[model samples]
Target: MTFNLNIYETMALVSLILYLGKFLRSKSSFLTKYCIPPSVVGGFVFALFMLAIEMTGVATINLDITLQSIFMTTFFTSIGFTASLKILKQGGFKVVIFLGLAALLVALQNTVGVSLASVFSLNPLLGLCTGSIPMVGGHGTAGSFGPMLEEIGVVGATTVSIASATFGLIMGSIIGGLVARLLIHGKKLTTVHDESSKMPPTQVGDYNEENHNILSLKCLINAACLLFIAMGIGSIVSDFIQLTGLTFPSYIGAMIVAAVMRNLYDFTNKAFVEKEIETLGSLSLSFFLTMALMSLKLWQLFDLALPLLVMLMAQVILVGLFTYIIVFSVMGKNYEAAVFASATCGFGMGATPNAIANMDELTNRYGFVPTPYFVVPLVGCLFIDFVNSFIITLFINFIS
Candidate 1:
């Protein structure tokens, strides 16, 4: 038997799964420690259930995941909003250097992945599933590029990418602290005392409750409008890029358009409600990821399991060494560099949140180091995605 769900049904189911995932995360320390997203947890469980049913000859499910693409585009569009060149300049020279290091890692990751895929006699495109697509790119990039790779005739790409991303989350968390500890203790680096380094204060008292609610609503509406506009224009941009005979992700155009709009606003000194846009993007990402995970074809992954494992293991090793030797030394061989190394391991193999978590753990255990806190997030979250995406696109076009 086969069960089909329409778009509304799919959305409802995804929402429920998200709640379930959140509840599970609340109860499970392992999930919390690893910083796994609730959508991933819930959707992965649902996928597993579907896999079990199929294996038992019980039933199959077909989900109308039409909204997945929209949600994905919206999230990437929000990321584009964050790509403010003005802010990059404000972050100063270290941010640029850190971004360069992160970008180099992206290239190295693809090189390792593609080279190993050849060694295993697998399609080089399949190697990308285990490359920066999952490692530096995390689940967001994996979800975006997985389907693209599939369209390029790479079977099981989505499954492999998702699986590799999950693995990265865990391994990134585990190794990040260890590497940082090794650097700090082995080199005997002293912690810096900077009590003045803290987050800037928010303008919370400017609006009363009624006015605040009204403002929030207005901001949300504007954010939605901007996202749709960018996405609409981005389709044209994507088409234009395709005219160049290069394969790029569909959201790339939207992201670029969004970035341009953001910078224009910055140039005009106009107030943009970034928090509202970020919230909207987070909501969209949850839905998109949930739908993507729940719709996974797990059976397709069986054939590529060994090669996938090998590729993932190699990536973990690469990230560790790269952070320990290059990132630490180049960033300056001090306490801040150690923290930066840990942060790099986190985001290099997982997500920026994992990087933050690693830094938080280090700060709490040792003393607080402010430079890494500032520089890592700026580079990892804002700049690295743009760099990684461009590099990945080049790799794809070159290999294809």
Candidate 2:
């Protein structure tokens, strides 16, 4: 028998799963120590349950994941909102250097993945599924490109890509903080102030309910308005760009629009609450990740698990060496480099949230360094996708 879930029902279940994951994280010391997102924990559990049932040939499920793209786009758009030209300028050479480093990593990941896959006698194109397509591109990119690969005769491409992303998410979260920890302590790096200060002001703000409740509401609404406008205009831009025969993710246009909006808002000296928008972005990311994990078709990945693990391990090793030898050195070999090293692991294998989580955890332990807080997100969250898309395309054509 087949069970189908509508979009609303899927959303309801996702929300519940998120809550359950949060509860479990609070109860589990291991989860807390690793800084695992509740959505990942909860969604993985559901996926495993589904896999068990499917393997038993008892039942199957079809989930409506339409909202997943919407949430993904929304989350990325919020990242764009943080892309103020002023901040980028203030970020100085470190931001430019790090962004260049991140872009180079995309090509490197594909090279390593494809090279090893050839050594393993696997299809070279299949390696892309395991490479930056999922590693740097995250689950969304994995899902988007999976079927295209399958159509070109790469078997189980979607499954391989998704599984790689899932593994990346967990491994990224686990090791990112550890990398930063080792670098910070080993190098005797120091923080200038409390790490919490690196967070958006609203996150740390204490407001009297009577005086600030209305203000808070207004801020949220304004953020929503700005996000909606960016998304709306972004869709049009994405469609127009597609007409030119060069494809991009829907979120790319939204991100560009948001960046422009942010710079404009900053230039005009407009009053806007960046913290509230960041909060909204965080919310969207949680929901999007939960939905992505919940929708995984685990049965599709069974045969490829061994190869996936081998390639992913290789990817991890490369990431570690690159961060330590390259990212740390280029970012100045200071306290912020340690933090950026952690962030590298996040988006290098996982996504922006993982990178942020990695940085947040390390900062909490060693104090906050603002450079990583600014540079990592701008590079990983905003710029990397554009560069990654181009590199992935180049690899596809090269291998094909």
Candidate 3:
């Protein structure tokens, strides 16, 4: 039997899975410690349930994931809104340096993946499924690029990419602290205590009930309008880019337009509700990820399991060395550099939240160092995606 869900039904199921994931994460120390997204937890469980049913010859379930693209575009568009050059300048030289290192890592990861895939006598594009698409790009980038690779005849690319992303989340969290610990101990690094080094409190998502009640409606409306406008204009932009015989992700144009809009607003002293936009993007990302995971064809992962593991292990080792040698040395080789190395392991393999969590654990144990706190998020959250996407697109065009 095959059961097909309509769009509304699909969204409803995704919502339920997201809530379940949140509940489970709340109850599981491991999930919370690693900063695993709730959607990943719930969606993976649902995927496993579906897999068991399929294996038992019970039923085949199909979800109407039309909204997945919209949600993903919305999330990336929100990220673009955060790419204001003014903020980048405020972060100073370290942010630029960290972003450069991260961009380099993305290229290296794809190169490693492609090289290993050839060694294993697999299609080179399949190698990209385990590359920075999952490692630095996380589940969002994985979900985006997986289907694209599949369309180009890389079977099971989506499943492989999602699985690699999940593995990265675990490994990234595990290794980050270890790398930081090693760096701090090996280098005799100690946190510098200075009142000037304290960072300002973040106001990005401070949605207290009072504040929510006051501004939620207007802010949400404005944010929705901006996202839609950017997405609408971005489709045309994407079409134009494709005319040049280059392949880019569908969301790239929207991201570019959103970045331009954000910088224009920054220069013009126009005010928009950034907090509401970020919250909406977070919600969209959860839905998009849950839908992507729940729709995964888990059976497709079987044949490539060993190769996937080899590629992912290679990535883990690469990130460890890159952080220890390159990131540590380039970022001043001090206490802040140690912390930065730890944070790099986090976002290098997973997402910005993982990076922040890694830094938080380190700061809790030692004293707080403000430089990494300021620079890491600025680069990791706002800038790295642009660099990663550009590099990945170049690789795709070249490989194709």
Task: Give the runs in model 3 whose Cα sits over 4 Å from its true position.
Answer: 192-214
Q: Give, for candidate 1, the lowest lDDT window spanning 10 residues.
A: 201-210
What would you estimate as the lDDT of candidate 1?
Answer: 0.88
The TM-score of predicted model 1 comes to 0.94
lDDT per residue as tens, model 1, 78-148: 99999999999999999989998999999999999999999999889888888899999999999999999
Worst lDDT run of 10 residues, candidate 3, spans 201-210
Instruction: Give all candidates' CA lDDT scores.
Output: 0.88, 0.78, 0.88
State which candidate, 2 or 3, has the greater TM-score: 3
- Show where candidate 1 strays beyond 4 Å: 192-215
Q: Compared with the true structure, what per-residue lDDT tens digits does model 3 show for residues 1-400?
A: 9989999888888999999998999899998877788899999999999999999999988899999999999999999999989999988988888999999999999999999999999989888888999999999999999988888798898998999999999899899999988988888886654323655433222322124524478779999999999999999999999899988999999999999999999999999778878888878989999998998889998888788889999999999999999999999998889889999999999988788878877776666778888888889889999999999999999998
Would you estimate the TM-scores of all the predictions? 0.94, 0.79, 0.94
